[model samples]
Target: MRTLHEAVLDGLPEDLAPAARSQGGGAAMTGPGTTQSAVSRGQQARAGRAGSVRFAAGRALPLFVRGRGSGGVRPAFTADALRALRARHGGAPVLVRGLSGAVLVLLDRQELRQFYEAGPATAPAPALGAVPSRAAVRAVIAEEARHLTAAATLDLVRARHAVARAARRIVLGGGGGGCDGEGGAGEEHPAGLFGRLRRRGAPEGHTPLGRSAAYAGRQGQVLRAMDAVPATLLRTLLLLAAHPAEQDAAAAEAAGSGPAEDLPRLEACVRECLRLYPAVPDLVRVTRTETEWRGVRHPAGTTVLLPAHFHQRDPEHVPAAHVFVPGRWKTPGADEDLRMAPFGHGPGRCPGDRIGLLITTALCAEVLRRRRITATRPVLDPPGPLPVALDPRGIRLTLTRR
Candidate 1:
């Protein structure tokens, strides 16, 4: 926590230094089942360490409690909850209690870096797991593309099913139980890496074919990370549609580019969409020990909620936060914006970020080059945030071949 605080202090801009100092005062520590001020911060910190274990065992009360007006849930649709949090707590860490009796520590930008970049000495150990082979993953994506091209009209159902089927095949193999059996004869490779893995009956943790519970879980996480793609992709298409000049620019850019091409305009469109609707709405982690960060004392065993949705859209960090402007990404420091965590940051960042971006951008470019897509309904009506899941509705597009 001390190291994190110093890092934040060092990173603060010259103009923002005074504000950082004032807000850097440590968080007030509250003891479990005790009135505020009844115990010293030192005592509370020690008690917090012992209480964390008891709390994990479901035997002790949370050492920290939620902000009074937080109402057990954080609302993503409206600004009320966030406004109340900032108004009542300033920059301090706000604790919010969940209906399940879980207490979460919600931290802002500076503190979040501390939480994410904690040194190996304080960081949690990495889970032992294997990722899907490149060939297997490419096979799944190719199958998904085939499905998309075969669809009569791209709607929410079809789009979601495409991604789900591909992800499942990557995780469980084409002929495994995870498959829907809709794949035709040409879809399966007779002696592919995945084929042999399926035949071997991947147990739980060990599978060279990338067929295991751990691999499947990671596949599921990736699919969830891509949840907003359909909607956000549709939105980006609409943006190009609305601005015919930009549409021409995009088409020209698309014609000259390949999948690996990092076209600035195309990237800006995707970046703007992510800024508005991040793939992962929130990031959750548990504290290993009672720690003070960004002037806030968080008890051990606290569930830390870094609401990336709120952070990326926060008005303070992003100019015209609610408005969608692809060109905003052209400004200096835009790419390095710390407030954005679409793929997360630091050591625990998603390993598939580059791959995901490549896949998404490539798909978008190909679609634009071949057909003009128009949304049948409003694509921006976000059906509220669902933490790790993307809103499943609000996107339907009809493609007209060019």
Candidate 2:
């Protein structure tokens, strides 16, 4: 079990530790304090009635856990919870006690943007040294596509395994072959890779233990990419299969003479899929210093939760929020808009986003280029509002030669 103090300091930057401790025992402000009493009456009322204990215990905890679980339906549950909260609070930030500590949930887009722009509150930028070049990535995608094309029907389960192998090759290096017989049994196991690194001798005089740790870190990166890339690809395929017109348009673009990276229509489809079903549906940030939103003051060590799934699909802000419209991304400044966080925003954004996008887009293009895809399982009706959750495991695609 974690102590309250430890939970409060979980993600605090080292430099801010002293200041956080010095301020009011690091307890998050739930009501107007002596210093905060000077604020206007309206702010006080809003702060005082921000969130309810019943709401936190009855609704927030379960939905949050479920949202973090595997499978597609969990995110929908989370989005529903946020929608209810927004209805009650009417765009004000809600302060509820999370399992860790006090959490402030931001509902307004502008407030969310402010929080994202506050650099110190976000996690540090990720290291991108191991990411491969475009040509190397394209080669991996082409090889994977060949494996898919050879199959009679593209099962998501098998595709996920193949993507894992490709991710391992891309991240840790030296798997370089088709999905069936690439780097041998060693490529299938992290321990095998670690041993190979040890035999090759450490880089820059790193000890055996140091090399092992480094290998473990890279393995973690591969695992994350494996999860995210496959989910995004699976969802994108499902969307395309359901919307025939869009699929045909994407297929035409894929068959063009232009490079895969420059396919705007295909990329827009992928982005639209992400907007509907984000790989990381919920984003959490811990405040390292005192933060203010509107007139309320959130103490240092407060946990800030942003339900990206809810915000991106909110019908009020996003036109045709539940519908698939790839053209939305083609509009000027759409990519940079904080409203849609397919790969997140600010310093905490996923560093592997470009690589992830490349892999998914290339695979989608390859499949669309040669095969006409139809969704076979858990059928989607294009005219209706799409399901909030799509279980990737149950998704099946039948491919016919174009």
Candidate 3:
């Protein structure tokens, strides 16, 4: 008779089932210890399967412990875990059980390129024409910079508030109406609009009273801008504070900027920051159709996960993976690299990427232009191995006027 572990592996693909069965050992006999033993055997059998790795539930605890609350260090913990998994399993994609379900983690950069290239087409990013002009965005950044400059010290909380205000103005236009809680009577606020849209039921075509396409799109833009911009800004600032040489170079560029896009060094710094600590560290997608890899078939609805944080920092592919090297971005073909997907890739890429980058780079330039920033809370020495995880909330900077 087959063991209980073998029976469990029976549901998996033919290619994987046999490997699991062979390692599962003999049939189990009923006893008080049987259930626990069966589970351990099953796990071992699962791990033994080719092209996959099984992690004990406890192995995922660091993700939970470190990756909670504001600026949780989940990405860092996850990258470390992925590095270990890759080292043991080689470059092949490994199936790791996640909190939600089975996740097929993509390890190879070439696989990542193919996965993104084959992704289903999504709606094109919203038109940049709808956004406030570049000048308007810069004005908002300058205003917020004034607020920060008045203060002797800057922390994540203050930084977030500044970004939020600027995001509101840029996305909503005309000072963002009432979203910042200072609008006059009868002005519409994002929160109020969001509530109304929520009450109206899903997006257009989903329900008769659903939010209109225009309203839904506008609401989405506002929310994404508000949430993502602050995170990017904080991370970039922390990175700049930690690397004085890069910071000085970026500041020199910021001081001579013709437009946000013209500031190459500052943009590189922001890009490096995103690569190091992407706001969205992991990308997950559900297989719409059955997908096959390395002679194994994954049925439809399979969860495919890309730990971008790991791929972007993999030492084999990315030189100075653990170091802050802004100049790498200036190298030819760097932008075309699929491994460094800070915003994401292909059709599903973030629609507001250009605007978001503009906002972040501009704000960073504004801060660095005339203020010397030093990180006080976490001491980061440039030549040493940078910490895998950085908490934005824990970041504190002292700004001295130049």
Candidate 4:
């Protein structure tokens, strides 16, 4: 457990760490010292000593486990708990400032408004490196949704077609294939889409989000284009998806640092980025040989399921821990995701990372350039990709028309 989490922490960039650390190496000043970090009496009451307690990189898990909540399962911390925690602590940011050492007071809510912000500690001039132009980022963003949505829809349509074809094969015992198979089921005696698919051996699996017509048309083209992209671009995309803050800093670094200067390797940052907004948080690790994590003894073949979303919010690894602050990824241990493996580490990290990153990076860049700035979209829970992982209270913006 210790080694796994440690590896996660080591690989992460400072942006992955959610909490602010001062130049003095102490916690960043939040509000006035009310100590509003996510640690709370209610949280402790919720999480009790049990066989399992999910802890973040630097956070301490509860001695007692709490009752299960939403998402068909218990959330590490419920939004109500966050609101309640804030209320108990005295307003939002003010209380959050207290979570570390002394209570902190940042610029006002309006001043601190923006989807992404750079702290004083974080701001440094970009190193001489190759940077994407403002126009290129814009083009990618303008077309990203079309491509991603289309890819998703096409996948589903193909799946549905595959199923229908399979049913035809069943009647003809592998006849010419399924375009005609549904006819045999008959307009009067329908076998249903699922039935047809089962006959074909799941050759065409569809994801739920692919319901729109527009989505279907664009997917194949984007995926094919993605196939031909260089490995470096793909790697850049995935790393950006998993670590937005790092992407921001990296872009700056790449431009000023040099054409091929020593930049932060993206692997560790990917783990942390997924920690914040995982594509698929369910990762299971089976010990081929016996291994011990965090001094806990385990025999071989231990199937350990890591839910990065839950662990990312744990106060241990991420300070402030609850805010949707991407800057959290910038801290040292902030980059770790031992218990928070989103793509599964080692050989099991996500494969479609290139596609995922391409979509995610394009989306973020668009927002930064187009949307008038402000604080993070008001989120009741910790950060995760909106709509995919956690549905947020639509990202409210105090925008100035650009």
Candidate 5:
């Protein structure tokens, strides 16, 4: 965790610096005790114009508010915001400046592909390096299951927090015994857990707030996944309910003679869920040097935004793009499915992507095997975004023993 924090914090200044200095671009002066160097120029720009961006960003408010306001300003309304920009700018990258200087938004899939595929020297600088260990992830998932079972009412917010706390415990080796349990399971505090983790691969020379920063970052990632998990599970259940054939296939897979047999249908359901509602719907990158992209000359330090939601749903790339087609991934020569990069793409893609898939798949399979799940609300009509998770409010599900 400390290593992850160091990698991110050490790389931040380089990530946010514009090619040249601009007036009023210095770190925001937030009164006494707030030194100029404490905040980066990019942060100042973000903070200075936060209100404008928050209020006038895009038309995603209704979609974001679906999960009881758990969805926030992360997506940035890429589809709507960039659609209008693309109409004016054509194929060239659209430059935008909010509280910051200049940001080139890449709405088209081709342009985004180029940016993401570009080598590390030119790719958008990574903001974090939080790849949870397999053990850590399994522990958190198990803890999350326990939390869900213990909850008297299904509050998405609390569930999200529970996941975050579990992750924090795993990373820091403190608090409750999620990673220290019996037989090195997720429920007890094992001896030398912290020392072992540290000696195994801890980054030396920790920064002042390295652990804290990493803990906070890990919590955010866990919360985002947790918030999305319930929705994904709900969507999976709703899809299974709507398609009896697929449900039967999944059930058969669950009841297979072998314990580790692949559950293709369940995996497909997860893929569809991610396609419809990615946790981080939009990705932002910045150029490090002056470059010419597709006949357009972009100056050094240009901010490029990859609208993942827009790209994933592009009719040109994805067949039946807008529909929830779980079996699409099972088709031969379905290279287009690779473009459904809800976790972004390329070198800096989210490290937790596979972990998230496993978590969601396990939860779906377990629930389906143990009980009959039914959705009481229309899946299409989501109520709001629960921070970053798309939530279908009043989505009642009755679970009956199989």
Candidate 6:
């Protein structure tokens, strides 16, 4: 069935400047389980040859758990803690993209409510079967990687400003636009108003769209910067970049393995990732039924935000939670994971887990093998409303390609 989000995406074609009224932002989205099946189906029909890009995940990407872009000064995450999180998620189950076809993201509140009315989805159902899958994992990792990468690329770009400034000072001993004749020195760098400013340094905070574009470009630069990624992942990304169908045979061959075993490990890995470094630092769930969590009292309908960073580290769920030793959660069971939901334990757990795990595992494995990772800047801190997957400060890695 189509969702309110799907309806909104459909509306965009007729009116680029989409208002909040008819699109369900004001009415439909407020309720927990309002369906928009008609809109989704209609859009799918309209999208036609546009393929899945414009129909399914295409419209949902913005609302994708990463959901929104980072708006302001993002806090910093401790390197030890984030690493520990990665370890926890090391071998957990995840949803492969193909398996995840036509899925929708159900938020925490929705999942919690479903517990009472919808029969609890207690048992940890296997997320992804192996079959050389990495799509869901890829999606999440792509988001997170983009988050990290955006921060890194921004850092690099900022650094380039300094480096460029220094280089220019050393060369012409002047600050002027490149267009200017050699009439004076220190006038300005002629890269243009924007280019000149870029050569020098960043201008305070950015606009909303500016931030979005910056984050998007950051991923591009980071990928280019880190050439020595996982061989399989790197080759795949490169091929995808070029001819897309470039390595279908290799991918198909890899997809031949049975995926049952992959579910548990991938889930575990995803949980660990969420615990250590969740895609969203803080997750908010509005109480549907009166409940108590960790001795806290909450009336029904009260909004509660769960900070994965803090909750994951809580002594109850983990022992010495700040460290990035994937071994901590090496033996997690479905029940145990439910309490400590990383990719969200219940139905709310990210549907894209299969793909997410695949990407994270492959990337991390590649990084461990090929690069020496180091932290140059503070990692992302407690997330705010505009939370993203990246830590603004750069995590410097001197990649020595193997």
**Candidate 5 lDDT over residue span 162-216, tens digit each:** 5445444544444544433423332323222232343445452376356444444
Compared with the true structure, all predictions reach lDDT values of: 0.50, 0.63, 0.62, 0.31, 0.50, 0.32
Off by over 4 Å in 4: 1-141, 144-274, 290-299, 331-344, 373-389, 392-401
Candidate 3 residue-wise lDDT, 1-402, digit = tens: 221111010000001111222222222445543322222332211123222323333235444555334333332333444544554444456676655667777867858876776564344545333454566668778877776667877776677677666656554554576565667754445443233444455344564334345554655665564565555666677777887777888888888776534677888888888887776666777888887654456788877877777778776788887788889999898877897988777776776677777778888888888698864566776787566556666667788898
lDDT (10s digit) by residue, model 4, range 1-402: 121011111111112322222221112235665342232222211111110111221122211231222111122332222323223323222212212322122111221221012111223222212222334333433443233222312121222233223223222233422344534431222132223333344333364333222222222222322221222222223334344565555445434433223324333343344554454333334445554332234456544433344445445544554443444445576433344444343334433343334433443333333332323333233253322232111222232222
Candidate 2 per-residue lDDT, tens place, 130-164, comes to 44555666667776677766765776656766676
Least accurate 10 contiguous residues by lDDT in model 3: 7-16
Q: Pick the candidate with the highest TM-score.
A: 3
Residue 119 error, candidate 4, Å: 36
lDDT by residue (279-362, candidate 6, tens digit) is: 444454554567443223335654443344444554434564543333446664643453355456554554444433454344
Q: Provide the lowest-lDDT 10-residue window in model 2.
A: 7-16
Ranking by TM-score: 3, 2, 1, 5, 6, 4
Better of 5 and 6 by lDDT: 5
What are the C-alpha RMSDs, in order, of all predicted structures?
11.5, 10.0, 11.2, 18.5, 12.6, 22.2
Once superposed on the true structure, which residue ranges of model 6 sit more than 4 Å away at CA? 1-273, 288-300, 332-335, 369-393
Question: What are the TM-scores, per candidate, against the unseen true structure?
Answer: 0.61, 0.73, 0.74, 0.33, 0.61, 0.34
lDDT of model 2, residue 148: 68
Residues 302-367 of candidate 1 have per-residue lDDT tens digits of 776676666776667766665667798898977666787666777666555654554455456656
- Rank the candidate models, highest lDDT first: 2, 3, 1, 5, 6, 4
